[model samples]
Target: MTDAADAEVRDGRDLYVEHCASCHGAELQGQPEWRSPDKGGLYLAPPHDESGHTWQHDDSMLTDYITRGGQAVVDDMNVSFTSGMPDFGMVLTDSEITAILDYIKSTWPDRIRATQAQRSQDAWVD
Candidate 1:
């Protein structure tokens, strides 16, 4: 298997650390009490780790969330929940967003990754 040091993996790690680590945790642990809203009523960034629901979403949903911001994406899906994630569409290229997502997925356990991949495929089929 290719090592984590591969160019895309390295770039994904670097980009995630620079852009997403602060809110999401350097290790993708997310913030404390992430399920609950903050003092400002904003949901804290959720973990991208196996413990979180990030794996439950497909790639398109994840990409849309990163690119369109949580609110807009949620709005598009008519979801009732509020999303605190900011849209990175204007600031980052599609490739960059994909890189970050690749980094996030790289951390998941094999089972979780497989499940999530299935979800992504199912979403497209539906």
Candidate 2:
């Protein structure tokens, strides 16, 4: 019999494949040398694994990231430039976004999950 956690992992994998794997990578490993600057000059794709900064972000911010994509602000100007990331708000429903986030959370270790929970609570207030 498959473990419940295993099932959850499978669901997460499905979500990742349908929504995130395009840029984030097929294994949640993110792009190559994701932490380093790439030819485009920005960091490629940072890992969402425990080694990544995803744990440092909160749910609210994560939600915004999925909804708004990434914007470049220079000298107080907001330029609606295309980012490596896309806004999933249109392509995927809120529930789907939530599922994607759930999948990410499911992959995290306990300590990271707890920290991210705190970050989620603090996510836009300060």
Candidate 3:
């Protein structure tokens, strides 16, 4: 990779550690009991790794979720639910968000990455 791309991924890793590690985990392991909701009905942060459903989503949806937060997305879907995830729209710029996502994507295996890329492309086509 080029130096600039390397730098962006590094920056993304740093930003993710600073902003997301608390709930998501330093290694992106996510919180415990993440699939189950709490007593208050809020779901814990899910892993960003291959174990989780992050790879199932397209980039645009992921970007929207990051920018708008889980609650907004749930609300848009008209679901009666609450989200512990907070919006980063005001806190991070678009490119920074992209970098953070890139860093997360970098950890996935080749097959997963290709699948996600196709999903992203399909999203745009649809």
Candidate 4:
């Protein structure tokens, strides 16, 4: 990781606590029954851990989703899904967003991180 990312990851812990922990969980475990939809038919927030599919996404997708909000990103993709996640672009700086992602990536096991890194590379190649 770059020094800035290291610093962001370090600082992101507190930022996550303040902004993301309540819904995403203090341990990044996500909400209960996250795969199931609620009465309103919205799926609960998914985990950011190895058990979750967060690592399946490339960095640009992840960062864009965070910066633009899930709904907007989905809309841009012409996908027919609703996301309960709100936009953070108005609230967070680009560095802070990267920091939060770095923090989340920091939690993954090495193998998973490598896979995700490869996926990111593949995305760029495509």
Candidate 5:
């Protein structure tokens, strides 16, 4: 890859650490009991690694979640629940958000990446 590409990947990692690591985990491991809701009925942050369902989503949906936050997205779907995720659209540019997501995608294995990429493509078609 070119130097500019390398820098962008580095920037993505840095952005993820700065904005997402606290809740998601420094290594993208996510919080404990992530599948379960807390007493207050809020779900914990799920892992971004291969073990989690991050790969199951398309890029556009993921982008919307990050840009608008889980609450707003779920609200749009008419889901009855609160989200712990915060909106980053005001704080981060669209490119920066993409960087963070790119960083997350970088961690997955080749098959996982391919699957997610296909999902993204399918989403565009749908």
Candidate 6:
């Protein structure tokens, strides 16, 4: 198999189908009532598109969210308890992860990308 750098993620639409469509919806619209919590007080999967707060994080953070899963890295069991997002470290090869990430980056508009880039840079300082 080729390396992550060698692999091409193509574009957001394709990536969304492979990596996110099952949970997030084919159009990145996420689940219905995604913002509202479930009966267990757990939040449903939220949208990754413009309507979502996904733009709040930078690329690295997003990567960590994928690799480590937000709950694991955040030191919060509650987050994990509520979050349906799974850890892909064992499931996805590094290159696949990178490609998925690239796909996510492709989805964002320039402004969001720039903002995310800056946040990722700031993370390096801490």
Off by over 4 Å in 2: 1-10, 72-83, 124-126
TM-score of each model, paired residue for residue: 0.92, 0.76, 0.96, 0.92, 0.94, 0.77
Return the clash pairs for model 5, or none. none
Question: Which pairs of residues have clashing backbones in candidate 2?
Answer: none
lDDT of each: 0.89, 0.72, 0.94, 0.89, 0.93, 0.71
Clashes of each: 0, 0, 0, 0, 0, 0
Alpha-carbon deviation at 88 in model 6, angstroms: 1.1
Per-residue lDDT over 1-126 for candidate 1, one digit per residue giving the tens place of the 0 to 100 score: 377446777799999999999899999999999998777777889999999999999999999989989999888888777778999999889988888888888889999999999999999999
- Superposed on all Cα atoms, the candidates' RMSDs to the truth, in angstroms, are 1.7, 4.1, 0.9, 1.6, 1.2, 4.2
In what order do the candidates fall by lDDT, top score first? 3, 5, 4, 1, 2, 6
Task: Determine which window of 10 residues in candidate 2 has minimal summed lDDT.
Answer: 72-81
Across residues 1-126, which tens digit of lDDT does each residue of candidate 3 receive?
799989999999999999999999999999999999999899999999999999999999899999999899989989877889899999999999999999999999999999999999999999
| Model 6: per-residue Cα lDDT over 1-126, one tens digit each | 245433465643465587778998776778989877789866777887767877787666677778877567555534345666778887677666667766666577888878777887888777
* Candidate 1 similarity to native, TM-score: 0.92
Question: Model 1: runs farther than 4 Å from truth?
Answer: 3-5
Flag regions of model 5 displaced more than 4 Å.
Answer: none
Candidate number achieving the greatest lDDT relative to the actual structure: 3
Top candidate, metric TM-score: 3
**What lDDT tens digits, residue by residue, belong to model 2 across residues 1-126?**
258656656776798898788778776778777766666766566677887787787787677777767542221246533346666777877766776787888888898999899877776567
After superposition, the stretches of candidate 6 with alpha carbons farther than 4 Å from their true spots are: 1-7, 11-15, 76-81
- Candidate 3 yields a Cα-based lDDT of 0.94
Q: Cα miss at 121, model 3 (Å)? A: 0.4
Predicted structure 5, TM vs. truth: 0.94
